[model samples]
Target: MLFISAITFGADYDSIGDSTIVRKRSDLTQKLYDTLLSIKGNGIFFGMQHATGYGVGWQNNNDSCDIEKVTGDYPAFAGWGASVTDCNIAQGEGFEDARYKIKLFHDMGGFNTMEWHADNPFGGNCYWERRHDKTKDVVASILPGGEKHQEFLTQLDNIASFFNSLIDDDGKKIPIIFRPWHEHTGAWFWWGKGNCSKEDYISLWQFTVNYLSDEKGVDNLLYAYSPAKNDSREEYLYGYPGDEYIDVLGQDNYYDLRQDATNMPRFVKMLETLVSIANEKNKPAALTETGAFTIDAKATMPEDNWFTEKLLKLIMYNDKTRQISYAMVWRNGSTSHFHVPYPGHPAVPDFIDFYNHPYTIFMSDMEKYRTKNE
Candidate 1:
């Protein structure tokens, strides 16, 4: 089978030297295109750093929701969102049994990240507590230490196999959006803050995609490249393995750290840059994860809602960027250290307007996409 590789985003098309691009009529794969062109974002996309599923281990009865409740909210994606978490651990049950209910959720029609493990990327727990210790070996599984080139490939292989076990909302192979090491530019977590080099990071991302797509049978995945919308457009902003290796180009930002408000423009400009790149290369843009750090009780801050409402509007109208497809919520509201968005807050109102709003006009454009592509 022939393959056209866009090694680096927006690289010159004619000269294919260090890069790879195999052009043939039928070379494009359905899964590959899904990553690059298809698979629009779920607007009310909510993420759970620590899900209630972990309560399954203790039979504690607090795993975030009742099976009945989730079942009732099954396809109520109107304003309701889906949960994605690290570990995918079942607190009351074993990994296997916990995963079974997880599959059941999707069997009824739902979507989730089936995420790789994380140590509270934006600060919070995945399964209530730390979920699991910093078992980077169990989670990241990178070689303890070795040459950056050799180690990157080895660890990538391990991460792919771990995530491949999941099923999608159809109870079939889970077409998960695997987002491993994200927001490397931020100095917040262990993964960033000079913990790893750029070459090391890029190699890991590329190798993971190759292993999953070519080695493992996980063709149902769209690897997401996410970064905390940083103030400066630092080098880490675009540190990807190229369009071929990455399925989606994404960014993650929040109103938690600063109330100064200047970060908003930085976010808009950075997203504009990323979306432009994705659009030029036939890839779509996504706000993979975002949220405010604090939500007051009873009183929903209209001020906070303004933040939610305005940022969303900017993503849609920005001229230099691609059409912003998904604006997800980083739903880890329980953590005290750092977190802004969570459930039951007025600011995080039902965003059904994405489909209903005249600004987005999503359904109409979707029809155009379906017709033009099909």
Candidate 2:
């Protein structure tokens, strides 16, 4: 499979990379970047995680989504997870389902992003498993010359195989934003700040990118570096793998915007810094993951209009922050643990208002941004 360069698209591809990373990027991948760059400064695209797979009061139903159920349209961006793609047979079934959903969304002119909550490689239960008194340095162990190095390569191979399998009806590859090791600034995951040294973390990120792009020949991807929320820009770029390896700068913030809407100024400050850094580096930025856990099993929302008054206000606060490419809420797991409002929910009217606002883009408004190949 010989991939062609994106010279015909008239994109400033050099700005995206100065190495082989951009050279091997597919034409659709470059077009996606151009599309996102054109969208910046105009409007922010709304997105949802695991949007079509399941939703509140539904599971694996065909052609249905919670956002569409409420807003009469689907989100412009759809997020998926690849945590169990390389796991056992029972777990790998989820990856197969994701492949179908990804292709379906792509065919509808919706953009896609993927994250990995990869299980801990060193005998731990899940990705959240931390290295304590009885565990090894997981990040170090998966690097170039450690004991679990071969196992890590096998995992990457599985992911690469999955990436290669995403094809359109015309048999062209579908481009997606691959975000791995997200929210690493927190101490909850195995790859968090305290669990791994800064050098080891950097090595792990660069190695993963190199392995997928160079060794495995996976070209239909745009890499994104997303860290947890940070007070200063320095904290956000703690273990950044350099501009050559990253195409987007993202931040996963749930505390300031969701926990207490009154603390919105902190989120605004972080957004300002994020957009500024993205501008300086010539890359797109996004609010990777965020949503008020209002309709949870144990708690209900204090305010009825959290979407318009809280989430939308945080993004539309200033011109710079509004330039963010997209803002995605979490998934709609069930009636109790959903992020977006479902049918008959009190937040429906306010969410509709947010959808009707010119600054917010959904799938219905994405026709103008379609690529030539698409």
Candidate 3:
């Protein structure tokens, strides 16, 4: 019921075959559609940053399993990773001087969905930015919702408008792989900071889906629900919108031996649990975010290497699985530099071997959604 069998071509997506909505320029929309198709059946949707504006092209690279896949950017640092841009022009080349820049990413191989963020589930106040308490910053809400709640709605509306405009090459809607409020189970980000109650967060999520599809009339979307490893609350992992609202289920794991105790058991278990739930619900699952610190952390090599080997094999195999569809390894060289050097990993390592073997056989061919290598 929840699992919808799908094949990602490029990025082109039409209204459930029978809806009428003026999408964005057909050319751009189609390119995205094809891109989705290219990786649809596969288990990995390698991520790119929406923060940095686009370059001429994008690449996934060999370090992680993504390997040199071209990438692009949205207007300004506006990847669905966070919240959408403000120009308020959420979608495309809307002819607005566009306070919102529309060219953030490069069109390397191009992509399927134009992911932008509305607001993170973590709270509005971030540690780095917008540290001001929501009570202090946003004007009080006049309507039923609180002021901060109202502001979140505005951001959500703006984002809806942006994604709703995508059109296929033949003047159809470009379906998006919408992964919003992702990684909410973790407390690092603002939304998951313990301020938002489960009910409140759920309201926010439900309201977002209602407004985006029902009110905004954006049909080109395949919602994805992702949670971070070592979730602070189990509700965050289970609090997904109904099947109609979600398409893929995934988890984010970054704690390697270099960071956490020993690899990402919590993350692996998180996936195992998620897969069981997804199976019950019928939706497919994926390793949406995964990576070992290429740099280095406290852990030394053999142990860390052991972690990687065990980790890769653990999630990539076993009975509970057969649910994983893709695995996107985060190999952002810049990111590796940004974080403290992973102790053992002064240099980032490549997952090409992992991807090349059983761990990734499903990539080239999506016939069986099982861990290829063990």
C-alpha lDDT of residue 324 in model 3: 68
Clashes of 3: 79
Q: Which stretches of candidate 1 lie over 4 Å from their true place?
A: 1-110, 117-162, 167-171, 231-238, 256-260, 294-304, 320-322, 332-374
lDDT of each: 0.46, 0.79, 0.44
Q: Which numbered prediction scores highest in TM-score against the true structure? A: 2
Q: What lDDT does candidate 3 reach at residue 34?
A: 38
Off by over 4 Å in 3: 1-66, 69-130, 134-144, 148-150, 231-238, 256-260, 294-311, 331-349, 358-374
lDDT of 3 by residue, 300-374 (tens): 232324323644566655666545655554323343232211322422242333334443432233222212210
Sorted by TM-score, highest first, which candidate order results? 2, 1, 3
Q: What's each prediction's clash count?
A: 23, 0, 79
lDDT of 1 by residue, 87-117 (tens): 3331211445445544543443333443443
> Candidate 1: what lDDT?
0.46
Best by lDDT: 2
How do the predictions measure up, each by TM-score? 0.62, 0.90, 0.61
- Evaluated at residue 357, the lDDT of candidate 2 is 93
Q: Report the Cα lDDT for residue 223, model 2.
A: 87
